[model samples]
Target: MDPILLGAIFITPIAAIIIIGLIWYQKWNYTFKDLQHIKGPTPLPIVGNMSELGDPTKIFWQLFNWQIQYGNIVKGCYGMDMLLLISEPEYLEFICTSQSTLPKGIFYRYLHKWLSFGLLTSKGKKWHQRRKMITPAYHFKILEQFVEVFEKNGNILVEKLRGEVGNPSFDVNIYLTLCALDSINETAMGTSVDAQNNSNTDYIRAIKEMNRIVVDRTIQPHKHFDFLYQFTNDYKIEQKCLKILHSYTLSIIESRRQELLNNPSRFDSKYVDEFGMKKRIAFLDLLLQSTIDGKPLSNEDIREEVDTFMFEGHDTVSTCMSFWMYLISKHPEVEAKLLAEQREIFGDDPKRPTTYLDLQKMHYMEMTVKETLRLYPSVPFMMRDTLEDFTFRDLSVKKGTQILMLPFYLHRRADLYPEPEKFIPERFTAENMSKRHPFAYLAFSAGYRNCIGQKFAMIELKSTLSKVLRSFNICSAVPEHNLVIKSEIILAAGNGYKIQLKNRTW
Candidate 1:
């Protein structure tokens, strides 16, 4: 073979590829021109600032440090994509409350595998319709129905924790999460998953694995494409996990739908008892009977919403409750006040069931829970992708850019809340709270896209935490072990949420 002939074969294609690559790079790199006003670490080609973002476990704090250096509104790159992180109150207000920014970020595509285009990921008219339809399910009136479920599951948690009481320090979050799973299953589907009693189950394991794979895919750029991701091991695990989660949800939905068909009036015609309480109905029941465009929602659509909430409902409350427990253990003064409040609510019997009205009456515990959420919001960040150009001061945010609202960083801004680092529950007092910007604290997020079941979560947290405080005196392990924060899809303690419990004596 002649050298000229060999060069013609290999060099011709190589030259064409390089020419195409250069053209692609120029077009791709040109999009960040509008974001030039925002400050961030310099990005490398392809990988962008991800190399500097460091380990996934520390990405939460790495981004925080970047914010501290770059100012409130910061931008970073993952490949050619741009991500904006804002801690400024006005900016947060603009993005969260405004209709223009309602659609979730591009990464939510990952959740489509499990959550689908449910309320958590849906957009435009569909999002509006689903949200409007689902809103009634979470009304304070309906949330009251689940108070007994919370009380029962919370009580089970207390009874189960009896073994841990007066014992060595242990990861209380594991128990609390199982208890929360039980509560969500019972309240959301009108059935018991019995997660509290049997911690090791296929469904439970699938839930954990699915959350991990979702977060993993969201951050890694190459996995963003289904063409590439479908070939990976995580994708295989994701499908298996989805099978378990969806099959369980579908089975429950079918059973509940048949029950609804048998006695349609059972869901309607509210019958108030002598105690003035209506029958407890699960979130699943409401969806089964709900209509979209005046037609019944399909099983998949119903499953999307039901599974969305069920997935959203559990670990969030459990993580919040677990962190609250850890916070109280560290601050005996705060715990003392919480214990006093519990005594006032339950009086002499610490192991009493909490009515919805009773939960509403506990003020300090609610404040403490809010404070816990401030420090460690279950979803540390909420993201939005601009469908239309968005403006903040001189910055022109082009369409397709992602806006990351990190409450973990925003809630810590000194200007927003003076002494922001302190865990002072009093800051949430009505008078003190009035001094702060409304968007300054976004634990449950804000405005139209905010969490629909926030009130439901609040009631659950109050009911569960109050029960724990009433039954046991909790303390962090001796010498106060610190938690390594993992701020992924769910904010969690990389180190276990460890605590010791002593039986309560009043």
Candidate 2:
């Protein structure tokens, strides 16, 4: 054979393998390449814009920088795939409200190891079914029943703070986290972790450790694959934490089921109605009996969902409350308004715990919470997988592309919110809210996939704030500009919110 023909034959097969691998790897990028005209920070060939991903803070900082440079809809890349950061409300409304775009994206996978295919992680038919099944758990009456639990926890939190009233400024994140944890335990599981009193409990420790590890996993692209994650020290620690968490929850679930079974009368008609036989108040009770299209959930399936609720219900609320407290501390005028509202609702007795109805009467305090959420949304952003090609104004989004909706940026839009950086509770009022685009303020997100626990969260916020303000006034040691925030799945302060508490004399 000729030398040239032999060389061509050998090179052709090797070239074919290389070409095949590249096509397979860059399939998503190629599919969305039509969007190349959309301006963003230039991405490298294979790794894309995943550089500096090891630091969670810098990862988000890059996104923010790109948003500033490129505009609301900034195009970026994740590995070999295309990503679009959508912040404008006009586009937000289209993506969030659409059922086709409801499926979660890559970052959510970091949570799935611990949470499994739960409501937050699941998609397609399974997600739709679980959503319907779980919807009733947050019913008005059910949540109203949870208010007493909220009030009880709020009282416990106030009592806890009473000791720290005159002490140096302390980070209240852990304190508030424990209170929220206790409330969720009692309300969601009908069990007491006693998080406030038993702060060193294994369950509490496990949850904290697990969250930290998850944050570590999310930022590092190399750790995203299961095989790579398994070799790390964090993975071993995560496994131990998961074991403690799962065991504790399983033990609690078993205990609760046995309690109901052993004593028939204890199963109140309010909780377990005759026809369908569903529980009333506790979220776990509903989960225990819940069926999707006449099929009941398995033990593993139930665990996934219960675990997800446990994580979301407590952690996010604590973060929100911490920031809420910090914001009130900085703005004494806002604090006075909040106190005035609390006084009007509670009257002569400042010690009275807020009822669900009391929460309803706390219109001003509610607005303050809304404004706080806008300033520091609990979940800064959400990821969605686009189901099909779509256009928002002039911009075109391709199918299978991941959409990063930055509620943090959207909430801070100067056009949408005047003096956007300022803490303005009045902005959430009916008149002011009516003027803004409905999707512009997405503290709890919006539309079909909005946070189901939003109302439950508000009740907890109002209940806790009412009690805290009634007992003590907030004073921040950390200056407004000095408080540094970083996005680690949820919005978190680098150094926790440090605020001194003064005993309120009503």
Candidate 3:
């Protein structure tokens, strides 16, 4: 071989080995040493505690046990990457409340391909601007207008349950989910999706498939890397789902844009209802009319928010409603008290449309929802990326570390909630709440990035449940102990929420 070629071959291999060694040292040596003080399950060589996540179906329980075994804060790893799992209320309060702890970590990136920068995944100045712009869409006044949509859907749900009355253990999940989709689409997209009417829309199916893929990816740590995940069939399926979802949202945006162009007066806020009162516009219209620093939201920007709202708005509240109904069925005394309150508010009218004032008066129902959330938060856990070097009590975390906050475990802490496993709505009464830590309960999360649609969700919950309760008495077929639960971004019962509805004789 020529002298130059021989020299190049030797040096290149040596340099490559050195580079790999340094990368390994940084990840395995330095990172592990820095977090050695924090208590957690021991990690293996390259995989770390990745396998500790074991079966995807049982991962939630494993993590819950770990949260107890390792104390409020435990350090774990996926490969050399570190994670700080937290269930402490004070620590959680700090993490959520502080302005600096806003950027979501790598996990949320999984949702980005679907959600884009629509509030849930956006960060920094862009997030702030979007938050401000979209804030008005969920305002109390705006949500008040959505009451008509909620009422229509609530009545639809009640009527649909008529045939199922006295049935033995029918799953209500599909019914509630469809009702939510219809209500949210009408309010969020300026149109009716007719999901409750059983419209076989690809968009709805895509949403369900996309959520399953996200859960699959999350539980399988090896699929975290894009390079490897790209080769998997799930990724291909996810792409197809995204196409359907995006196409649907884009079409809606185009339709609304054309409608506004043909009738400029529709863009104006002067339209009066039959009562001569100005009607509130759809969420899509609000986004179209909004300007942030002189620029209106693009179709893409508007689509992201619309898609985000569609995903977040419907399933979350619907899931909560499912549990709310199940819990009521399990506790007859609680249901009796709840029915009494509803009767007091609306009198004997089973078809009374729930108003903003009526929803506000459903105080006990709100507490029951709160207690249900404490046991089963819609979004079970949240992750945040460290923006800077951080310290927690005796432990230190470097910049770029991922933080996992577990509201599921925190809400059930024995120190905070006295019989943590019991179904007690009175635990949230004003006096009891005042005595507890403000951050002890985080049903819709907490702090700056806390759920923007919380008020809207609460109203939807009360309205839907109030309507159903007025017409039918709900009972669950499965006992609380018999229910098998799992976490998939949102908590779900593995066997489904099976219940029987009996028409109220009064």
Q: What is the lDDT, from 0 to 100, of the residue 311 in candidate 3?
A: 86
lDDT by residue (284-365, candidate 1, tens digit) is 8888888988899999999999889988998898899889888888899999998888788788877667888889888999
Looking at candidate 2, what is the lDDT of residue 358? Answer: 90
lDDT of 1: 0.85
Question: For residues 394-456, what per-residue lDDT tens digits would candidate 2 score against the true structure?
Answer: 767778889998888888888888898999999988999999899998888888888888999
Candidate 2 clash pair list: 271-280
Cα deviation of 285 in candidate 3 (Å)?
A: 0.8
Off by over 4 Å in 2: 1-29, 269-280, 478-481
lDDT of candidate 3 at residue 291, scale 0 to 100: 88
TM-scores for all candidates: the values are 0.94, 0.92, 0.93
Instruction: Tell me the alpha-carbon RMSD of every candidate.
Output: 2.5, 4.3, 3.4
lDDT of each: 0.85, 0.83, 0.85
TM-score of predicted structure 1: 0.94
lDDT of 2: 0.83
Comparing 1 with 2 on TM-score, the higher-scoring candidate is: 1
